[model samples]
Target: MYLSQVKSNGKQYIYLCVYVGTQEYSTRKEKRVYSFGETKKALIKMKRWKRKFNEFPNELLNLGCGMENLEEWIRTIETGITKTGRIFKTNVKRAVF
Candidate 1:
């Protein structure tokens, strides 16, 4: 189910305070929502969300790999999901796709 989704910087992020699953999913267990953005920007947004809910956003994301769906699809090329609960910016090329 979708709720008050953020339209910031062409990415949609769901927050605990603004998300409430639909009726079909009676139980609103805010879980992995997908989003996209630069690492710094995403973390800033996450920090804001944590400030409001006192909790972290356990989101499922493409890690901001290039947006494509071919054999080189950005979404499909990422290594895997990470659950880091802190903000970090890196100059390492390997870290970013």
Candidate 2:
């Protein structure tokens, strides 16, 4: 997601461009643009979108700070193993048992 500014007929406008993956095999990507007219509301929306995308998740494997919640983490692993009937690779440096 990104923001773009455009000028038309002496009026400047802000646009939010979101890259959406296409379902069809022929087209790999598509752009979804949302126009927020030059107004205070547009600024607020842009800030909100910027905040949301700035914290986007890049990977699912790493749980940096969440490692502190040992019990919940253990439960999650156990539940996943039970449901999938397979063991997942974990980077557990120490084990109580």
For this target, which candidate reaches the highest lDDT against the unseen true structure? Answer: 2
Clashes of each: 0, 0
What is candidate 2's local distance difference test score?
Answer: 0.40
Q: Using alpha carbons, what is the TM-score of model 2?
A: 0.30
lDDT of each: 0.33, 0.40
The C-alpha stretches of model 1 lying farther than 4 A from their native spots are: 1-33, 54-97
- lDDT value, residue 8 of candidate 1: 59
What is the C-alpha lDDT profile of model 2 across 1-97, one tens digit per residue? 4334456686555554456777566473545345555433444433444455443223211323222222332432333332335543232223223
> Tens digits of per-residue lDDT for model 1 on 1-97?
2212344575444322235456474675454345434434544544444345433333422333221211121211122222222222232123331
Model 1 weakest lDDT span, ten residues long: 67-76
TM-score of every candidate: 0.25, 0.30
Residue 5: error of model 1 in Å?
A: 21
